[model samples]
Target: MLENPAPPPRTSPATLDPSAAGAGVPCRAHPERTRIGNRPARRRRAARIGVPTDSPELNWLRQSLRACDLLASVHSISPSDRALVAFAIEWAPYGGADTEDLFIKFGAQRNRFLHLLQAAMIPRPSDLGHLRNLKTTLCNDLLRAWNDTPPHNEKQCRRL
Candidate 1:
């Protein structure tokens, strides 16, 4: 009979700092205050993609935006990457609540800005719900519109 493997070493809970466990520190340039516990797990997962610890929040945002930009670059340079265009569209609209104020503080202009958001096809409504109510509403409306639009392209259709 094979011997049982020993259990992994136990970590002390006391050593774990919940405040720092998954929280992001805000960049000095952004006007918003950094709250330690406000980040959702999905955001945390997305943020880990290309963000470095010392990078500013602006830099992090830029990196997130770059995912879409890279997809565009791929599509422009190589048609083969068209397969990933859907993912690119999804990434473009997959921002968190952190940037809402910067975009929506303009009041009347916010509607126009939201329209631009509607153009980026996202993959999931639950992902949209991770944002604020206004953003979620806009995303849901755009999703419905996409579903209603003719020329049914399975590649472009997002599963809510």
Candidate 2:
């Protein structure tokens, strides 16, 4: 009879480096994986998040609006408007929230949400620096997109 081979040395759990296991794959012990009887397991690719396509202005606006670090200048705005502004700021990078999100979050339809968001943007003080500019920029882009989305025809835009 053939002599049995010696087992591989055991490794302490604390010494396991997750990177060695592979990126996005969790580390786990599998000592018997070297046997010819057992087929090698396939490695899976790491999951990835997809970034959206956007214009330079939209990108700038997204980053700029989101970087607001002070709230002192926004006190003059009403409480509901403040919430709307905060929500807009939070979702700036995502090209504002979708209609479904608006309904779920604000309990309002698309048209009503846009109106409220426009109102909310009005009271933001000039002291907010880029944030004030962000209001005009964001509102214009959002409204433009809305207008361009017609029932079933080309958008008759005359921005020139």
Candidate 3:
């Protein structure tokens, strides 16, 4: 006759009720393992600025911002902050500023130009005079930049 095997080891009360023993409850799906005590990890904080993925400047800015953590400073203003605000404005959509054949063409280029005009990076007073001055200066600068370049010909249009 075959010998009877030793009886399987019995579970103690403490082992069965892990919570009562201060080990916490076992996971419902995984009864053999004790529940984790610590809180779950948090998601990483994201940058407030939004920029297009295709922009090389945006990639460089993100890397630089991550390395420095410039946002940590309370009062100091950094170049990264300026760039962030600029790009955020650049990517934002603008309503009809001009019409083509009674239709408005809204695209990245038009938005960028609108952003350069409307972004609040420049300092100003509450008075209307200051605002007007700021607008004039910005418009003049834009005119100068655009006028510096010669007009594109049919060949340039074809190449584009």
Candidates' TM-scores? Answer: 0.23, 0.39, 0.19
| Local distance difference test values of all predictions, in order | 0.40, 0.53, 0.37
Q: lDDT-based ranking, best first?
A: 2, 1, 3
Clashing pairs in 1: none
Instruction: Score candidate 2 by TM-score against the native.
Output: 0.39
Q: How accurate is candidate 3 locally (lDDT)?
A: 0.37
Top candidate on TM-score is 2
What tens-digit string does per-residue lDDT give for candidate 1 at 77-103?
133333223322233333322235424
Candidate with better TM-score, 1 vs 3: 1
Cα error, candidate 2, residue 48 (Å): 6.4
Q: Count the backbone clashes (under 3 Å) in each candidate.
A: 0, 0, 0
TM-score of model number 1: 0.23
Candidate 3 Cα outliers beyond 4 Å, as residue runs: 1-107, 110-112, 115-125, 147-160
Q: lDDT: which candidate is best?
A: 2
